[model samples]
Target: MKFIKTKLLLAIMTSAIISAPFAIADDTSFNSEIKKAIADSKVGISFRARYEGVDEDGINGASDIEATALTIKSRLTLQTGDYKHWSIGLEVDNVTAVIDNYNDLTNSYNGSDSIVIDPEGTDVNQAFLQFNTQKVKLTAGRQRILHNNQRFIGGVDWRQNEQTYDGYRIQYAVNDTVSLDYSFVHNANRIFEENSKKSNNLSGAFHFANAGYKINKAHTLSAFAYVLDFNKAHAMSSNTYGLLYQGNFGAIKVNLSAATQSDAGDNPLSYDASYYNAEIATELGKITLLGGLEVLGSDKGKAAFSTPFATLHKFQGFADKFLGTGSSTGMANGVEDTYITVKTTLNDVKLAATFHDLVSNEGHIDCGTEVDLIAAYSFKKDYDLLIKFASYSANELSNDTHKLWIQVATKF
Candidate 1:
């Protein structure tokens, strides 16, 4: 009978992990039912758990080896104080992949191996609400929005599933360093896990707005406008404006940004994409030198996109690689590909390098190329240990790929 109910849910999840630290003090009466559900309601709850792994090489359908996951996030809050400016937030995530989205497990226990979880399951993730005064800050349900170097609209955090925006957000602070932000998704819980976090059942969705400027001494600038209404019909939406600059001279620190995108109207292939990002850092005393560059531009079939709301491995290259969308010939279209990163850190040792040039900005073909390497170490201030590797080569698409990532992250 279904392998005895999958061996009784893997023996009740391996006896709840050997009785969970002696039953965690009997769960304190279910955490007092979450503090009596906010006892007179000023409510608050917090939780977080993240685990990730990726070791690949199965020739570019993505996901080749060691794909592990476990994202158990719970955040709940409700407030009505600070003088009625208002606040309310709710987040619940129950992602339990527990190693196998690309861990391969010999391709799903060679078939019919069902422990039931992730048949496109587990979510809620966030249910936003906020309103602040002193220069406006208004937010409306389902949030997690990001901008300014999110490349387009962040909050991916290298996936164990992230990307939230059921829709509506706005923040304006025009002084004390300038600010203006807006996000409108209307739909996109995405990340069951991909295809733009999937499920846009179609009927129109996605919109964005931003204007950030701080120009006085070593600048900060942002301007963005976006719209994506995919009710199918060749689905396309675009509008973007960008500029960013960060500065420091004595010890060397610089950041530069430039962007230009068009095609919010007039489809039938109008095309757009122009981006250039540069970063340089220096320390020389304990070895902390870094370099960066990010580029994506090619409009042959409307590609060059990012910011599915922010944090795609912190600006494209934590080796999650291209973060999604882009396929040649039959079309996937997202990652025209261009990369360069060199890093350094000394203390507990960390070094990194990356190189990629997969061409085909459509009729701008070269098809594929990649090279990556990393090393990390740190222990006794919490913990950290990592080693990563990558090599992908596909000329004119398909065949040749390899990836590996080993990681450890913790916070308390």
Candidate 2:
């Protein structure tokens, strides 16, 4: 792979610095240097509290139940100042379930009640050493990684516990209009930390690459490739290549993207699938109208395209029926979603409403429909409040489901 060569280059560059001659410094000098670096460091803290409720009925296998989850997540972060082009960051995270009335898939309740994925846990969210220059940057250790819009790889921040990776990353800026990024991920630490055995985290050789170019202020394009080879969860391993474009013309905006996927190393099955997405939006007065269509194709009912490490909650629908597995038939019968949205701001409150029509990719089965509503207000520079709701009505596919969330967050 191209990333392998890039990784070797990074290793060589890093080793050159490490193997350079260095004179031993006196204890006083060493301590002074450390103190200076600490004095120049920056520290930050964040707290988020959320109350989420889910009510679903008429589901097969799992019993229909109502669930309420009151979760509080706290984070403390410190970033040291650059010392000879090197810096370090440490972030600690803790999520506490103040009130838990649902089945967090990993908890003892497993599948007893409506699923609420936030489980209680404390973890080292990010601990990385970084070397940065004007054009190139390199980082290593456990850290949060988000590629593009978090479509293929991302930190699942919607859940109380965020996803992180143990890996090395390199980013280079070719010029003002072009940039490149690559990361070699060996292990992924998923959201379910307290229950490691049930955690969706995977050990793998994952390579992520992206190259982006800006034609101008109103237009930009990116190409990305993701290769995943799992050691244990072999069935989910795959490779994907895609391109993305975003541009604005006057009051109108547009986005187009497409990708193809196939089974990769260690995958238990062999299949090929594809994905396509396009969106357009326009603004009039205070309101904006947006429409989009997304398709995840199937390999002749053999397998469907899947992005297991993505922030799945951000796509399809907020009701989250399509979050875990790839398609309606587990490994086959892909998904096609058509959606429209209206958004505006009034008296400092941002509001949006979205409607989605879903179907199966191959047989064109009517999957379901969903309506989403959101209202948010940044009450202070460091504080915000949000209320969101999702209502999904069933068709021939899944059952009816509804979810509601009220959250308050603060950062400093």
Go through the candidates in order and give each one's C-alpha lDDT.
0.55, 0.84
Candidate 1 ranges beyond 4 A from true positions: 1-82, 88-135, 138-143, 146-151, 161-295, 298-321, 324-359, 366-412
TM-score of each prediction: 0.30, 0.90
In terms of lDDT, the poorest run of 10 residues in model 1 is 112-121
Per-residue CA lDDT of model 2 for 257-326, tens digit only, reads: 9999999887778999999899999998999999999998898777888998899898889998877445
In lDDT terms, which candidate is top? Answer: 2
Candidate 1 clash total? 16
Model 2 quality (TM-score): 0.90
lDDT of 2 at 220: 97
Q: When superposed on Cα atoms, how far off is each prediction in RMSD?
A: 23.0, 5.5
